[model samples]
Target: MHGGILGCASAAEAAGLWVMPFAGVHVWLTPTGHERAHDDCACVVHWSEALAFRRNRAVMTVPLALEQMAYCLGKEAFFVALESALHQHKISAEEISSLRALLPHGFDELFRLATVSAESGLESIMRYRLSLHGITVRGQISIPTVGRVDFVIDGWLIVEADGKGNHEGPEQRHRDHLRDAHAAALGYDTLRFDYALIMYDWPSVEAAILGRLRARAGRVVAG
Candidate 1:
């Protein structure tokens, strides 16, 4: 194959998409009929069993690419992608469900986490991590005095993940701070984490969330 057109990003980065991150003189298996690249990259080719499927359902095909992603990158990466695609309207939950039947082991759980409400890959990753711990999370929750918050846990805690582009500027940051304060005033404990903290330092972030959840439990026990 000369030109490859897979347009999904790496296994990490919260549903970040890319089309084969390898650059220049890339030597890899590209199946049978992948499109010739319009860019500057030399390539070598090898055959794969996945390419034997129908013209529309071959190795580089959307569903097979998703399946390859699942098996190659693992379940979490696949579902993160699934969430991003659903969120961006590149694919629907129904379409994802259809792919589920064709995928191998580990796909069922990924299908479970796939949804359209996830606004960003960061949110998707957070929600998925929380879910593995059995914590129920509600998306884009609206309170009486507060507008839509990112996610709500047990109706007692708010988890807001501010991506760089969304919450970096002074004016936007000021508004986010005010929202956190207002949410706290309304008896909701707010945990604000940024992209780096959530993505790179997940254990710390997870601990903070678990600590808050435990405190909420302790409050319940006391009352």
Candidate 2:
């Protein structure tokens, strides 16, 4: 019998084991549990019990399951679980569509998840799209002259996703302007888009980006 180190008090109680309240949950162990440790608090479970709990799918929360999978099976396995959750709930399509509207360059599903805010559920959608495109999109980047940009495309194009929080103060706006100037001086193209452009007028933003990419391609060819 194998058991994980962590289990809820209720679970331990149901198993007919003596449980000691620790934190918010019960910790279960052998009668001599107190004899082993000197200071640090840790839960001990029988190996058989741990294995049983691990095999019991109903015992784990989604986040817990994800963490377990990441620890045991690695990141690729975690991604599989992520995609399964998205599809199982029938949210993947909606998320992908939303991101497509915002980013025409195409993104992977992970981006959808990354950007889905808990309040609005957009972070997941953003994470998913970014995963699909394999864009390696990060939330923020700081360059010496550019200061910081919201996102970097291929380490060259600085993309700013201008939400209200980002543009609230005059100081922020001035700082952004300086960052853009610095990025330009460093031969990096900067693209800034407000929330409206990202959420409502994405086509225009896409076109601008596409045009710039095309121009850059032509320059490479000519040079």
Maximum-TM-score candidate:
1
Candidate 1 Cα errors over 4 Å, as ranges? 1-61, 92-94, 219-223
**RMSD versus native structure for model 1:** 5.4
Per-residue lDDT of 97-198 in model 1, one digit per residue for the tens? 667767775667667665688787688888888888877789878887778988998888899988768788899888988888888898988899998898
Write down the lDDT of every candidate, Cα atoms only: 0.65, 0.47
lDDT per residue as tens, model 2, 45-141? 3222222244453343334333333333334334434444443452355544542443324224333443321211122223333444444555556
Q: Model 1 — which ten-residue stretch has the worst lDDT?
A: 18-27
Candidate 2 Cα outliers beyond 4 Å, as residue runs: 1-139, 219-223
Model 1 CA lDDT for position 210 = 86
Report residue 52 deviation for candidate 1 (angstroms): 8.5
- Assess the local accuracy of residue 24 in candidate 1 as a C-alpha lDDT between 0 and 100: 34
